[model samples]
Target: MPVATFSLVALDCPDPEALAGFYAGLLGGEVQKYNDIWCDLRTPDGIRIGFQRAPGLRPPSWPRADDNAQQLHLDLTVSDMEAAQERALALGARPLDLDDDGGERNFRVYADPAGHPFCLCRT
Candidate 1:
Protein backbone atom coordinates (compact mmCIF):
# COMPACT_ATOMS: atom_id res chain seq x y z
CA MET A 1 0.00 0.00 0.00
CA PRO A 2 1.04 3.53 -0.61
CA VAL A 3 2.07 5.59 2.37
CA ALA A 4 0.92 8.85 0.86
CA THR A 5 -2.43 9.74 -0.58
CA PHE A 6 -3.04 11.98 -3.54
CA SER A 7 -4.51 15.29 -2.49
CA LEU A 8 -5.13 18.25 -4.78
CA VAL A 9 -3.22 20.02 -7.49
CA ALA A 10 -2.63 23.65 -6.66
CA LEU A 11 -2.02 26.34 -9.24
CA ASP A 12 -0.36 29.68 -8.66
CA CYS A 13 -2.30 32.54 -10.14
CA PRO A 14 -2.79 36.22 -9.58
CA ASP A 15 -6.43 35.81 -8.57
CA PRO A 16 -7.53 32.61 -6.91
CA GLU A 17 -11.27 33.21 -7.24
CA ALA A 18 -11.07 34.14 -10.92
CA LEU A 19 -8.92 31.18 -11.83
CA ALA A 20 -11.11 28.89 -9.82
CA GLY A 21 -14.17 30.26 -11.57
CA PHE A 22 -12.62 29.74 -14.98
CA TYR A 23 -11.83 26.15 -14.19
CA ALA A 24 -15.24 25.58 -12.65
CA GLY A 25 -16.94 26.86 -15.80
CA LEU A 26 -14.95 24.55 -18.04
CA LEU A 27 -14.83 21.48 -15.83
CA GLY A 28 -18.34 21.37 -14.38
CA GLY A 29 -17.41 21.90 -10.80
CA GLU A 30 -18.45 23.72 -7.66
CA VAL A 31 -16.17 26.51 -6.51
CA GLN A 32 -15.42 26.84 -2.84
CA LYS A 33 -13.73 29.88 -1.49
CA TYR A 34 -11.35 29.12 1.34
CA ASN A 35 -10.28 32.72 1.49
CA ASP A 36 -9.08 35.54 -0.74
CA ILE A 37 -5.75 33.81 -1.06
CA TRP A 38 -7.16 30.40 -1.81
CA CYS A 39 -10.04 28.81 -3.72
CA ASP A 40 -10.86 25.37 -4.97
CA LEU A 41 -13.00 23.57 -7.54
CA ARG A 42 -14.34 20.15 -6.86
CA THR A 43 -15.20 18.47 -10.14
CA PRO A 44 -17.79 15.81 -10.77
CA ASP A 45 -14.95 13.35 -11.32
CA GLY A 46 -13.82 13.92 -7.75
CA ILE A 47 -10.80 15.89 -8.76
CA ARG A 48 -10.02 18.90 -6.65
CA ILE A 49 -8.00 21.74 -8.11
CA GLY A 50 -6.76 24.51 -5.91
CA PHE A 51 -5.86 28.04 -6.92
CA GLN A 52 -3.70 30.28 -4.76
CA ARG A 53 -3.13 33.98 -5.01
CA ALA A 54 0.24 35.25 -6.13
CA PRO A 55 0.21 38.99 -6.51
CA GLY A 56 3.24 39.20 -8.81
CA LEU A 57 2.65 35.94 -10.61
CA ARG A 58 3.65 35.79 -14.25
CA PRO A 59 2.19 33.31 -16.72
CA PRO A 60 4.37 30.88 -18.50
CA SER A 61 5.55 31.41 -22.06
CA TRP A 62 3.83 28.34 -23.40
CA PRO A 63 5.12 26.16 -26.28
CA ARG A 64 8.42 27.86 -25.64
CA ALA A 65 10.99 25.88 -23.72
CA ASP A 66 13.52 28.66 -23.28
CA ASP A 67 13.68 31.63 -20.92
CA ASN A 68 10.26 31.05 -19.37
CA ALA A 69 9.12 27.44 -19.60
CA GLN A 70 5.64 26.04 -19.34
CA GLN A 71 5.77 24.78 -15.76
CA LEU A 72 2.55 22.86 -16.20
CA HIS A 73 -0.70 22.77 -18.17
CA LEU A 74 -4.05 21.06 -18.10
CA ASP A 75 -5.46 18.98 -20.96
CA LEU A 76 -9.25 18.94 -21.05
CA THR A 77 -10.98 16.33 -23.14
CA VAL A 78 -14.19 17.32 -24.89
CA SER A 79 -16.78 15.51 -26.95
CA ASP A 80 -16.80 18.11 -29.69
CA MET A 81 -13.56 19.99 -30.21
CA GLU A 82 -15.13 22.81 -32.22
CA ALA A 83 -17.92 23.48 -29.78
CA ALA A 84 -15.57 23.19 -26.83
CA GLN A 85 -13.19 25.64 -28.41
CA GLU A 86 -16.02 28.09 -28.91
CA ARG A 87 -17.07 27.75 -25.29
CA ALA A 88 -13.54 28.11 -24.01
CA LEU A 89 -13.01 31.20 -26.10
CA ALA A 90 -16.21 32.67 -24.78
CA LEU A 91 -14.99 31.91 -21.28
CA GLY A 92 -11.96 34.18 -21.76
CA ALA A 93 -9.55 31.56 -23.02
CA ARG A 94 -7.34 33.09 -25.66
CA PRO A 95 -6.51 30.87 -28.60
CA LEU A 96 -2.87 30.03 -29.04
CA ASP A 97 -2.71 27.78 -32.08
CA LEU A 98 -6.16 27.16 -33.50
CA ASP A 99 -5.16 26.50 -37.13
CA ASP A 100 -3.04 23.58 -36.07
CA ASP A 101 -3.29 21.37 -39.15
CA GLY A 102 -7.01 22.23 -39.40
CA GLY A 103 -8.26 19.55 -37.02
CA GLU A 104 -5.67 17.04 -38.08
CA ARG A 105 -4.05 17.49 -34.72
CA ASN A 106 -5.31 15.78 -31.60
CA PHE A 107 -5.25 18.93 -29.49
CA ARG A 108 -5.44 22.71 -29.68
CA VAL A 109 -3.63 25.04 -27.31
CA TYR A 110 -4.90 28.13 -25.53
CA ALA A 111 -4.12 30.49 -22.69
CA ASP A 112 -6.52 31.16 -19.89
CA PRO A 113 -7.35 34.67 -18.73
CA ALA A 114 -4.65 34.23 -16.11
CA GLY A 115 -2.24 33.30 -18.93
CA HIS A 116 -1.72 29.64 -18.10
CA PRO A 117 -1.56 27.42 -21.17
CA PHE A 118 -4.06 24.61 -21.47
CA CYS A 119 -5.11 22.23 -24.22
CA LEU A 120 -8.51 21.18 -25.49
CA CYS A 121 -8.21 17.60 -26.63
CA ARG A 122 -10.76 15.61 -28.59
CA THR A 123 -12.27 12.82 -26.61
Candidate 2:
Protein backbone atom coordinates (compact mmCIF):
# COMPACT_ATOMS: atom_id res chain seq x y z
CA MET A 1 0.00 0.00 0.00
CA PRO A 2 1.07 3.56 -0.59
CA VAL A 3 0.38 6.60 1.55
CA ALA A 4 -0.05 10.07 0.24
CA THR A 5 -0.11 13.55 1.80
CA PHE A 6 -1.09 16.92 0.47
CA SER A 7 1.94 18.77 -0.82
CA LEU A 8 0.90 21.83 -2.82
CA VAL A 9 -1.97 23.87 -4.19
CA ALA A 10 -1.36 25.14 -7.68
CA LEU A 11 -3.32 27.90 -9.42
CA ASP A 12 -3.24 28.97 -13.03
CA CYS A 13 -2.29 32.62 -13.56
CA PRO A 14 -1.29 34.65 -16.56
CA ASP A 15 1.79 35.85 -14.71
CA PRO A 16 3.17 33.40 -12.20
CA GLU A 17 5.39 35.92 -10.42
CA ALA A 18 2.58 38.41 -9.81
CA LEU A 19 0.24 35.80 -8.43
CA ALA A 20 3.03 34.22 -6.39
CA GLY A 21 3.78 37.58 -4.80
CA PHE A 22 0.14 38.12 -3.89
CA TYR A 23 -0.11 34.75 -2.16
CA ALA A 24 3.28 35.08 -0.48
CA GLY A 25 2.29 38.37 1.14
CA LEU A 26 -1.10 37.03 2.15
CA LEU A 27 0.34 33.86 3.70
CA GLY A 28 3.57 35.28 5.07
CA GLY A 29 5.50 33.00 2.74
CA GLU A 30 8.57 33.37 0.60
CA VAL A 31 8.41 33.06 -3.14
CA GLN A 32 10.84 31.15 -5.29
CA LYS A 33 11.13 30.50 -8.97
CA TYR A 34 10.25 26.94 -9.85
CA ASN A 35 10.85 27.43 -13.56
CA ASP A 36 10.18 29.87 -16.35
CA ILE A 37 6.52 29.06 -16.37
CA TRP A 38 6.02 28.44 -12.68
CA CYS A 39 6.65 30.06 -9.30
CA ASP A 40 6.04 28.78 -5.78
CA LEU A 41 5.78 29.96 -2.22
CA ARG A 42 7.26 28.07 0.71
CA THR A 43 4.62 28.76 3.32
CA PRO A 44 5.29 28.83 7.05
CA ASP A 45 3.54 25.49 7.44
CA GLY A 46 5.73 23.96 4.74
CA ILE A 47 2.91 23.75 2.25
CA ARG A 48 3.69 25.14 -1.15
CA ILE A 49 1.42 27.40 -3.20
CA GLY A 50 2.36 27.15 -6.84
CA PHE A 51 1.49 29.48 -9.70
CA GLN A 52 1.65 28.33 -13.27
CA ARG A 53 1.57 30.61 -16.25
CA ALA A 54 -1.46 30.42 -18.47
CA PRO A 55 -1.18 33.19 -21.02
CA GLY A 56 -4.83 33.23 -21.88
CA LEU A 57 -6.17 32.44 -18.40
CA ARG A 58 -9.60 33.77 -17.62
CA PRO A 59 -10.55 34.34 -14.01
CA PRO A 60 -13.66 32.77 -12.57
CA SER A 61 -16.68 35.01 -11.95
CA TRP A 62 -18.35 34.45 -8.58
CA PRO A 63 -21.10 35.86 -6.37
CA ARG A 64 -22.60 37.97 -9.11
CA ALA A 65 -26.16 37.85 -10.36
CA ASP A 66 -24.90 36.32 -13.56
CA ASP A 67 -21.61 35.00 -12.29
CA ASN A 68 -19.95 32.07 -14.01
CA ALA A 69 -19.52 29.10 -11.70
CA GLN A 70 -16.28 29.06 -9.82
CA GLN A 71 -13.94 26.12 -10.33
CA LEU A 72 -12.29 26.41 -6.89
CA HIS A 73 -11.38 28.84 -4.13
CA LEU A 74 -9.11 29.23 -1.14
CA ASP A 75 -10.20 30.07 2.43
CA LEU A 76 -8.00 32.17 4.70
CA THR A 77 -8.33 32.69 8.44
CA VAL A 78 -7.71 35.98 10.17
CA SER A 79 -8.32 37.61 13.56
CA ASP A 80 -10.10 40.77 12.53
CA MET A 81 -12.49 40.56 9.61
CA GLU A 82 -12.69 44.27 8.88
CA ALA A 83 -8.94 44.78 8.97
CA ALA A 84 -8.32 41.72 6.89
CA GLN A 85 -10.85 42.82 4.34
CA GLU A 86 -9.25 46.23 4.14
CA ARG A 87 -5.81 44.73 3.67
CA ALA A 88 -6.99 42.35 1.02
CA LEU A 89 -8.79 45.11 -0.85
CA ALA A 90 -5.64 47.20 -0.73
CA LEU A 91 -3.81 44.24 -2.22
CA GLY A 92 -6.15 44.16 -5.22
CA ALA A 93 -8.91 41.93 -3.85
CA ARG A 94 -12.51 42.93 -4.45
CA PRO A 95 -15.48 42.14 -2.28
CA LEU A 96 -17.88 39.60 -3.71
CA ASP A 97 -20.75 39.44 -1.23
CA LEU A 98 -21.90 42.54 0.61
CA ASP A 99 -24.40 40.81 2.85
CA ASP A 100 -23.37 37.55 4.51
CA ASP A 101 -25.26 36.95 7.71
CA GLY A 102 -24.19 33.39 8.37
CA GLY A 103 -24.91 32.22 11.92
CA GLU A 104 -21.32 31.51 12.67
CA ARG A 105 -18.36 33.73 11.89
CA ASN A 106 -17.40 31.74 8.88
CA PHE A 107 -15.88 33.96 6.22
CA ARG A 108 -16.17 36.82 3.82
CA VAL A 109 -15.69 36.15 0.13
CA TYR A 110 -13.59 38.23 -2.22
CA ALA A 111 -11.96 37.99 -5.60
CA ASP A 112 -8.27 38.20 -6.27
CA PRO A 113 -6.63 40.54 -8.74
CA ALA A 114 -7.56 38.20 -11.57
CA GLY A 115 -11.10 37.78 -10.17
CA HIS A 116 -10.61 34.31 -8.70
CA PRO A 117 -12.67 33.77 -5.58
CA PHE A 118 -11.09 33.42 -2.12
CA CYS A 119 -12.25 33.90 1.46
CA LEU A 120 -11.21 35.39 4.77
CA CYS A 121 -12.49 33.48 7.77
CA ARG A 122 -12.40 34.21 11.46
CA THR A 123 -9.50 32.44 13.07
* Top TM-score hit: 1
**lDDT tens readout by residue for model 1, 8-49:** 989999999998989888998899998899998999999999
Worst 10 residues of 1 by lDDT: 96-105
Candidate lDDT (C-alpha), each = 0.90, 0.82
Q: Write the per-residue lDDT of candidate 2 for residues 64-118, one digit (tens) a residue.
A: 4345568789998888888888888887888887455852647888888777799
TM-score (C-alpha, index-matched) for candidate 1: 0.94
Clash totals, every prediction: 0, 0
* Model 1 per-residue lDDT at 110: 96
Candidate 2 CA-lDDT value? 0.82
lDDT measured at residue 31 in model 2 versus the true structure, 0 to 100: 94
- What is the lDDT for 46 in model 1? 97
